[model samples]
Target: MNATKYIILLLLLPLLFGCSNDGINNNNRYLPNYGFSVDINMELPLYTNLQFTGNPVYIDQAGVGITGIFVMNTGGGYVAYEATCPNQEISECSGMFLQGITAICPCDEAEYNLFNGQSTEKEFPLKQYRVEVVNPSVIRVFN
Candidate 1:
């Protein structure tokens, strides 16, 4: 009500909203924030298989994703997902395997659709990275 009281209230206002999760990216907690990014050059031997549609390519490189990065061309576009199980923390068994059209988590046998990163048995879907076609010959995946 008074000038002193208003000053104190204003000073404390920002503190009340500081140091919180903000809740926008709450799902990143499930896996370590190792970062997911890769540039797929279709002409390279390692990524030559990815030039086709519906073929899933699993890259087990370190520091790319939690377990690794799984990428595929869904006929519509390219998509990438973190290779760890979305429902749990990163563990020895939390790394998923690429099946025909799904990523199967060995920890709990949770099956996630690779097309849209959805799973019926888990509350969270697979963590997807952003895909950008850099050129006709290359595409970059990142989060």
Candidate 2:
């Protein structure tokens, strides 16, 4: 009986370790679902920077919070992040700005990386959305 239990435990160990929230994080609190769409044209002057690698842009549309969306080109692909200050109440000062390669929160000054939404100063990472490249010229951002 003990041998059978040990075998079962060994088998279950791999499954338990595989089921992890490695890439996805739900650290943002007190946020409401405010879905929006953004269609970007790389040819346009406003979005021409996205054609280059490691360039981030701030879009002031989408989400129920004060901040909008922080979009960037990671060379591998495009990524979109919620510009709201994570783990804080939605308020006027909760919007974040794109400072170099990091998202700077106005209220608490928490910084998050635009590439992978990892927090630099705090434990909570910024919320992110799905980005789809419709074509070489067009990109869509949605949550």
**lDDT of each residue in 1-143, candidate 2, tens digit only:** 99999999999999989775436555455666566777888888988989988899887854422467878999999988888887678888887888888988888877788888887567677887778899998999876
Candidate 2 error regions (>4 Å): 1-27, 62-66
Candidate 1 residue-wise lDDT, 1-143, digit = tens = 69999999999989997755422242656875565567888898888878888788898876787778889999898888888888887788988998888899999999999888889877888888778899998999777
* Collision pairs in model 2: none
Weakest 10 consecutive residues of candidate 2 by summed lDDT: 20-29
Where does model 1 exceed 4 Å of error? Answer: 1-28
RMSD of 1: 5.5
Count of backbone collisions within predicted model 2: 0
Q: After superposition, how far is residue 66 of candidate 2 from its true place, in Å?
A: 5.0
In candidate 1 the C-alpha lDDT for residue 6 amounts to 95
RMSD of each: 5.5, 5.3
